[model samples]
Target chain A: MKDLALLEDNAPKPGLWTQIAHPGLFLGWSRHLIVPLAVITAALAAWGLYLSFWGSPPDYQMGDTVRIMYVHVPAAWLSQFCYAVMFASAIGTLVWRHPMADVSQKAAAPLGAAFTLLALFTGSLWGRPTWGTFWEWDGRMTSTLVLLFIYLGIIALWRAFDDQLKAARFVSVVTLVGAINIPVIKFSVDWWQTLHQPASVIRLDGPTIAPEILIPLLVMTAAFSMLFLTLHLVRMRTEVIKRRIRSLELAAARAAAGGAL
Target chain B: MRAFLAIVARDLRLGLRQGGDILTLVLFFVIVGTVLPFAIGPDRPQLARLAPAIVWVAALLAQLLSNERLFGSDFEDGSLAILRHAPLPLEMVVGAKMLAHWVLTALPIIAATPVLALMLGMEGETLLRAIGSLVLGTPALVAFGTVGAAVTVGLKRGGLVAPVLVLPLSLPVLIFGTGAMAPMVPGASGQALLLLAALGLVSVALVPFAAAMALRFAGE
Candidate 1:
């Protein structure tokens, strides 16, 4: 303990941000965050569920089925939100070489993918009732599907590489390159929908949704965001630990080889 | 500029040395187009209607087929690292390689497009526009494909994996390329061509840096 303490004292001091980003310090600091965030997520989910199903009144046109918006909207929002997080983390990995940044990126891809898939699945279920078809090759749906594939492809890239550090640089380049699609997806509706033909079939853009419906949608989005944060933090922790185990195993193998020599 | 030209010339010579590889891509592209009409039933008007979409899809796939080949040999032979440390920047090296790739693979495919177009019963103005769209759009495909190639250079079985990473990003190019081929908007040379040009310009401008970065790390 004295040797450990002295070693800690001998280490050079880093800035607050740099210290926080250190994987060792991240492990120490992020532990306190998990439980609180998890509890908050649970609370918000419960309240949001109640508001979505029970508190909000039925829509006059579509009736109770309109409640699907509470879940669908948030999942769609998270799909984009998670990509944005990964893109930022990728920048962190490349520009600053922050060790935690790649871990954050790796942790986020599948989560973003899950949310994108959820958005697609729920959107289809809602579509059957609303658009009278389970699938449409419209701009918004097509872009989201492409986004899902991008996430899956990134995961495949991760699996293909043996060295995680080497993978980070390449993945960061791909992630940054893929970022251009985000704005294209965001404005897809506006670009393809109007001027010649109005959105008579799909009335998705409710710029003036009622307060009761709006409140639940916002609450559910917040809950979903918290859920994502909780999952991301836990996943990052596992990845950091997994990498630690990898290095330790390598070291052990080297020692055994040296002993034979 | 001389160094960049030399790099381009080297890649071109290397590609021409194995010239059958270029023929294979053109043949692969033609067969992909040929097979489509067989599946969809070769109704002349229908084939004409679908020709643009077919050509673009085939072009995208043809570009994808050569992605791993772009850097696989160079990295394995340690030439990539040599190129990296060359006086010209890695980005310029990448751009030169991309130009060579476009010449060796895509240019042959485009030259062979007329044969596929003739087979599909397409003619005249639309055929010209189709080739125009390919000229404008393929640089973007080459950029993305080169980056995909660079990204996968470190992987043992990267050839199979390059398409998985590249195809999703190729969506916009496909959309605009197909649109540009058809006379979608009749007025004033069409909007799709302009959009295709923008996508091409932006992708060419920005994507080389990414490819260069991937190559840099691959060397490390």
Candidate 2:
């Protein structure tokens, strides 16, 4: 009775960090999220796609090529958005030392890279007809490409270390360094734009875009956001299982070694 | 103070002990410069126009050659482990190492850049501005590279990883560095110079802590 009471007394109340970061608890809740989230993402995506392709009118200046904006804008937004999540997760890993945060950071990299590449791809598609060139060395395009490279570098860093725990620390530093770097590069490239283009160049989408196009774009972005959330939660759950499997494998290997000894 | 100086001195002494290494970096820098003309065609005006950018890229690549070893030797010998526990903070040690790296690697390249630029047909103020940009920008390069070095120091195949990681971060420096080479307006390059210096100073100021954090956890 005394020992049980002592155990109860000693147990620390979970804080916000712990509540959010507990991998087992995360797996439980995230499992529930996966289905509903995927369903919503699909519905939103269909609606968004329908509105983008059929519902909205062709752009005045860009014609039908403007439809590519629906996919391109969201991918571009998610590219930065995913990095922001990774950056926060990195801070969480460093400060909180939580496996969930590490899982998020590890999971977000490839997704971020995919989004960045998509941004580059869809952007080039849009660029071809609009600019009469498949590639333009403008600040936005160049910076996005650089952002893609940064994402790849982070992914590479994650794979470089044999020990995942140690990798987390190194990755956190790199992520933070990258976060600091992104703005500086953005500024510098935009500044370069001033040098190369003394005259203002074409805007991808002019400010105050008509609501007909803007609503669908926003809906598609929300769909992308939902898709990213569903994927992120699912990835985090898989990472939890992967870690468990890794530990079990390590333990079995140790047991075998012990038996031989 | 003494401890900080000691790291810088130790690294400097060790770097100097390997004489071919410095020569190799300078050679690499020049070779990159020489190869560009062949690939891009040796139109004098075109070469002159591209000279500043060529120098900046070569300088960055040269810095990368030394980055893989920035902390590897010490980490291998376990001195890095001890240093983490030492009286001086790891940030100070990283800062010292960064300074030493800058001194050994970047300085020689900076010294040789004017010659490379001159050979590429950049003359007078353009050559001077290119060199000036190097003076301001290379520290930012080293500062960011130190973080890359510190991040990858634990990896077995860190060489390629450091460049991949460092190059994107170096984009701003490349832009502003080349910007300072030819001021569009008379005072324009000055603004580029100021931004480059800010990048260098800001990076130099903050990178130590980040490197130190990475070193600490990676060591554990």
Candidate 3:
């Protein structure tokens, strides 16, 4: 009995790190940040549009269609960024067992999918005027398509499980496993594109492109990043509240059962 | 070591005794291979051109057909529980099961590839390269599929989930496998073959630990 009592007394408690990482602590702060984040995103987006449409010069070779790069490139960057965040959250779920990590991962999937779809859509629209074809199975395009599929797969895995906790862990493992393909996709797509079309190699940010184009692209990228952060924070808060409600309902059901008995 | 061999032997025996599924996998491969020429028209040159891709895709799908059961039956019958409690590492248990799966499913597909190559009108050097690619690539396929199967083993309809989860992960294998047989690419085939072997080696080295963890989670 003494040993048992000592064991009880020495039981592990949530550490300082977990306490800091807890979603509830951020709940009030997130609500406050959302409005400011939205305003910043909107202001930047409006400024970005002004620069992209009016301030930026038309490309010497491609002309006005160069403006499409403002949307397509930023969406492409965010798609990869979102996956990287999900991958980090996966590591958190598996290694540190962080409570909020899985919630963040689950919240980020649809956003990543949306960004990937926008990249593909805007890319194809840009392609028709530039490449004379709307779609080409080149390395970058195909890999982006595969990335979209992966995002959908993760989302489907999230929906497949009825239990959120189990779903989170399973999704984490899947995310880490899928993380293996991200670099391969990037490398192979670049290599494939270079091999098939040696002349028309699309550089991510080449020095040849004037600074006028670069500034708007950077602004647009910032705007997209801020938007992702705001959405991710809102979704995470929703997930936490949903989980709390679920647990309360479970406890209430147990209490009612006990009373009836 | 002895426990690993025993688990492998036990699974192999169970697979051989229940061989109907093996037959189904083979038939699936043959049917998919045979139907492609008809769907694409009986153009001999086109069939020859598509033969390597067709064979690789069929092998991928056929191998996938059996992955859901890689751990499902053992898990359902409580054999996996006994293995879990045994005096051996769970990773070894998983490796042994995956090895048995490759033996039962992938070996038959490899053996049947030359025949599928013939049906697709591929000949001589192309058939040889196709076989070489399959031999090097299938281990990776089976390894990743085992991970998928382990992840979904707890679900009642995990079989459906296995392909979606595994297919994207297997893209590199598909690309390199087909790349290995593309005659138009001068020195690329050799590089692709080496990469495919590397992928297989990495998958062989890494997947068991991941699969074992997934199994443990499912067991919980």
Candidate 4:
């Protein structure tokens, strides 16, 4: 009747590490994925580097440094997009208590945090060459900072509990409810005269980018999405292993007591 | 409904008996207000610009300070179990607790803001907005804090944990509560008010059931 005790008793059979550690087997389920993702990412980075130096056109407005958009834009886009995934997963967990929803929530936090950092880093990089300063209290940046804080909050809340299940549930609920910030960030530019430009790529009508630019941007977006997937699979595997190890340790202690008896 | 009122009144009496609790919150508010002006320096214009936010933040911290005891006393004394078993729906019980919380904690914070306003040299239209916003806003804070307190109430060290868990959820209130008073600031105070009201309505409708469920889980 005690769920935690039952979970400990049913801990994954030993050697889960050996099971997943094989490079070929590990890469099998992900081979089609690993090869294509790597190829595309490298190609895009190459294309981006090429464009940064040679092939790509300059921003009529922003000039050569606008090239940072290749990285910055996708990072910002994915950061917000990852939050949307986290929020959805949070809702799923809170409303239905789906088991996988916890995995999804746990997986999404660090990804979102990484994306946020990428956006800020590339943003600062782009800003230095373009805006003559690296940081500003513009609404977009402020909300991005808020997004980072929310991510940190999620991680902190998750770590605050001694009981993992309780911590997961608590953080899950908070993430879903706190998602009100996503829309707020998107509309911040429109609502306030933010220094960040209004939406140019995703719009009600359609994307306004020239095909030449749009293609690379879309490719990069795909590459980043795949990167998140690959990282997610690895992280979730690690979490599952970690949980199994914890249960095994607990079971060992319990078994030693039974033997003593 | 009458039973609910009785519960509310009973809670109010308990709150009154523990008068020092509310007094401590007001004292925290006063001390926080006093320290902020000195910390930020004596420039009047800067104070005027910062006063609304500072007051709201201090109020939030004080509310959080008081939130630890919100359900802990009753939950520990087995009173919460009695309330849960009572004929009233958990939502009603939650509502009553939220009302008691507002009466004890938020009401004083709302009242204290005007005094803080005076101390910080706030004048005219902004002062009125500060009072108006807090009056409209703090109920939602109390309601939201009730849910948060309920969620974490069963955990050890939950008091410290609750604020970090709740603050992000409380941002809309903070953003708007301060926005309502700081007129030149770009946030839509009216929209923020609407959101705060909606938050109160939703929390009132849902939180007691949620709290009840969380309590069950925690107790188990």
Highest lDDT against the true fold, candidate: 2
CA shift of A188, model 3, Å: 4.0
Taking the tens digit of each residue's C-alpha lDDT, what string does model 4 give over A40-121? 6677667655654566677677777767777777788888888888888777677777555666678789998999999988
Better of 2 and 3 by lDDT: 2
TM-score of each: 0.95, 0.95, 0.94, 0.83
Model 2 earns a TM-score of 0.95
| Clashes by residue pair, model 1 | none
Report chain A TM-scores, every model.
0.91, 0.92, 0.88, 0.76
Clashing pairs in 3: none
lDDT of 3 by residue, B1-220 (tens): 9999999999999889999978888989989888888889989999999998899889988988888889888899898988988889899998898889989999888888888887788989988898899989999999889888888888876667778988888888887888888866578789889989998998888888888888887887
Query: What lDDT would each prediction earn against the true structure?
Result: 0.85, 0.88, 0.85, 0.71
Per-residue alpha-carbon lDDT of model 1 for B27-110, expressed as tens digits? 899999999999999699999999988998888988899877887888889888888778998899888888998899888988
What value does DockQ give for candidate 3? 0.52
Give the alpha carbon lDDT tens digit for every residue of A127-192 in model 3: 888778999676777889999989988887788787878877888888877887678656655655
* Candidate 1, superposed: residue stretches over 4 Å from native: A1-11, A185-200
Tens-digit lDDT string for candidate 2 (A231-257): 988888888788766666776788789
Model 2 C-alpha lDDT versus the unseen true structure: 0.88
Model 2's DockQ score? 0.84
Using alpha carbons, what is the TM-score of model 4? 0.83
User: Candidate 1, residues A51-118: lDDT per residue as tens digits?
Assistant: 99998999898888898889999999999999999999999999998778999999999999999999
Q: In model 4, which regions exceed 4 Å deviation? A: A1-55, A180-207, B185-213
